[model samples]
Target: MLDPRFLTIPITHRGLHAPGVPENSLAAARAAIEAGYGIECDIQPGPDGEPLVFHDYQLHRLTGAQGFIAATDAATLAGLRLLGTDEPVPTLRQFLDLIAGRVPLLIEIKDQDGACGPNVGTLPARVAEALAGYDGPVAVMSFNPHMIAAFREAAPHVPVGLTTCAFGEDDWARVPPARRDELAAIADYDAVGASFISHDKDDLDNPRVDALRAAGAGILSWTIRSLAEEQAARRIAQNVTFEGYRAAY
Candidate 1:
């Protein structure tokens, strides 16, 4: 269940990246808040191991740049402009400063491959440090179970969410049912410590949702783009993290 202390509509994906808004930019976050939406942004560690807000493994999609985020430093990232704005890539700390206390921040940590990987080793600590004194609801999420586990140990007080795609017995037919149950159990353990479960909207009816909710996890669905998907999510999720749509309800 969602902590009663936190607002119900905590935030939306990429902080309202619409036609005119640049995804993951402070300008976009501010726009979302101004229009009464909380903010959700992606966090990844740069080459220097600083937590920065970016979505893709490479910068080509958002910026015309041509390298992986992990290969660049903050200074270099700050030099290139995001596609739609003069604004450069904003560090997680800079993003927090912009949205501090104004609205809740949902930080989605990207997977940097494996346990003890350079990106995983340093980013979580930096994110925890950046949010040390912020007086608002802060949550961390990741598609990587190991990374989520690390966050649970590193920042216990700050809620964490386990992100999953829509895969089930039918999807994973080759895998043994026992293994699937074990994976689900691991996710439940993280959800028990997490604020919510952020998942792909299409997975609403997946058994994992029932399992996680039964274990007392709150539901948050992501990148909702259409009215039908949005309405479907409302029935299952406590909050919807979106990209194109500004108004959730």
Candidate 2:
């Protein structure tokens, strides 16, 4: 049932790892390349409206900085070190250059809970611009269906997908009840024109995912942290967007 075009190869979530290379750092990307695995990274809008390769909404966890990632300009971000390491945050352009067509790159565009703030409205376009001349296999995805649609229009040649999970109690405060239900049910698949569905590993049993795969849509699962998890993912989803340990194919 897996879509061979994508899951045929292995993928590393936030790239390969080491003691020094933090997640989403350029060093992590290089580590993934050296290890011969497909690369995956998170993208967010920078203060200057450019797309930067970062994972969190805030910089405190990774950079020791005390502000939102959208609050700083790309130049300022380039100057700050990640996790106290000498390695600085790299832009999407820099990330693509490093990959250089050697392996496929999957980009997850981070969303701000459907709230348009700062440069958030223009993120899909900026990311498309960054991927313009890159000669490689690249794809974009987001939890926000609207953003996914935007990317489809902006870069029809590049495959776009929807990354989703079944919402539960913990998400109620942040997400509206009706909206949560819609996402949990994947109610926007056809409307968004998603080329793939990156469902949460725990929610892969959803019948909708199975339906999509039956229809020839790619199904990729995320954050697989162990061999056991990888094995489980293979039985259902096409690929594993993994981390915490190297994925052994």
Candidate 3:
């Protein structure tokens, strides 16, 4: 059976945030904990191979720094503040320590193209090591199917999933339409032993999503920004990985 814990909780994307608490910041994680919501965070590898709680490949978008996040060492990332906030970018171990299994965590292992950027084949093993004994209700997912397969081998007990979207014009320009179709279809679900799927909110019409849901696998929708959208998503999905606005569900 699917874990009732995941199905029952409303997941806050990049932690719960408002005003000064930046997304994926420890402060945001604390806020989510305080509000009693499941937390979602994205992980990328630092130059030292430590998994960092972050969302973007480039640091400039959140930190105003002029380099790739994967190029920065853990020590350098730990020292920098996020968008002038007091919160520094934290390692996965640090973030896990703060949570201390108090709330469920949905960790999104980020990737570029088909691999985990510069980390390549090492990220899954690193993340598995960090999460080795964590007692929290945690799951890992990635937009890259190969990453999911890699992580599955690294942590067989941890629930792994695929995060996919139906391609828009911009997304199609980047990845060929044929590739997008394959992704949306979740071609690797069986291969990776995926327990859930976090799909794009705009792309809920996907047949693979329907097939998974029909087969009783968990289905979560991403980046729901409003109560209406959350409600709309809940009609098809079991839960939402939400952000921007507080989720009422």
Best by lDDT: 3
lDDT of each: 0.73, 0.81, 0.84
What lDDT tens digits, residue by residue, belong to model 2 across residues 110-198? 87545311223888888988888778778888887878777778887788888888877585456677877887788888886777888
Q: Stretches of candidate 3 above 4 Å error? A: 113-119, 172-176
Ten-residue region with minimum lDDT total, candidate 2? 111-120
Reference-based TM-score of each model? 0.85, 0.93, 0.93
How many backbone clashes does every candidate have?
1, 0, 0
TM-score between candidate 1 and the true structure: 0.85
User: Worst lDDT window (10 residues) for model 3?
Assistant: 112-121
Task: Give the candidate order by descending TM-score.
Answer: 3, 2, 1
Alpha carbon RMSD to native, model 2: 2.5
Q: What is the lDDT of residue 1 in candidate 2?
A: 21
- Candidates sorted by lDDT, best first: 3, 2, 1
